[model samples]
Target: MKAGFVIEEHVVVYCDGCGDHYSEKDNESICFHSIAQAIAYFSAHSATVGWVYDGDRILCDGCIATLHCLQYGHTYPDTWQTTVWPLGKLTRSRSCAECGIPEIEAQS
Candidate 1:
């Protein structure tokens, strides 16, 4: 089995034409080292992110590649845009869908 590598700080990686994590914006293939570095930085900080995979029997990777973007001052948590609702959050206040008889309140 091939072993995965952990990335060190501030190292440069060149693509090996596997293109698994390759992007046209990068103008070359993606390599394991570059991906490891990106994964390290991303996992270090808390962020809501997503990814896609390609190719068969071969693996490659990439990342947002911003070492200090959030540190430079971004507002709020990563999931802030998800919009949770508090309409039925009150305890025993007759807010449930199946309690048609009405709720007498949790303290009752």
Candidate 2:
């Protein structure tokens, strides 16, 4: 007779900016369970005011906000024009089926 222990393991993807790890079960849009997904998402969109996952890490919300502040002197929260205007005058380069939707709201 033999006794053995079985341990279940979960893989987590880490956000590059904050080093925060997220699992597949986590419903947060900012994090992804796979690095390939993160890379695909980041490379697909323009880094105007949203999250970007570099090859190594997902530059999380806080970091993106910081980048905006550093580059433009203020954070444009969920501003469509700021993000859209630069994409060759509101043109999406590729099909946006896999792209995550930006949280849209009026900027006060």
Q: Pick the TM-score winner.
A: 2
- Summing lDDT over every window of 10 consecutive residues in candidate 1, give the lowest-scoring window: 51-60
Per-residue C-alpha lDDT of model 1 across residues 1-108, encoded as one tens digit per residue: 546896554433333334333333545533435555655643553233222223212222322222123334322222212222376333333322221223333321
Model 1 TM-score is 0.17
Off by over 4 Å in 2: 1-6, 23-50, 75-108
For candidate 2, the per-residue lDDT at 53 reads 60
Query: Each candidate's TM vs. the true structure?
Result: 0.17, 0.37
Q: Where is model 1 more than 4 Å wrong at Cα?
A: 1-20, 24-65, 75-87, 90-108
lDDT to native, each model:
0.34, 0.50
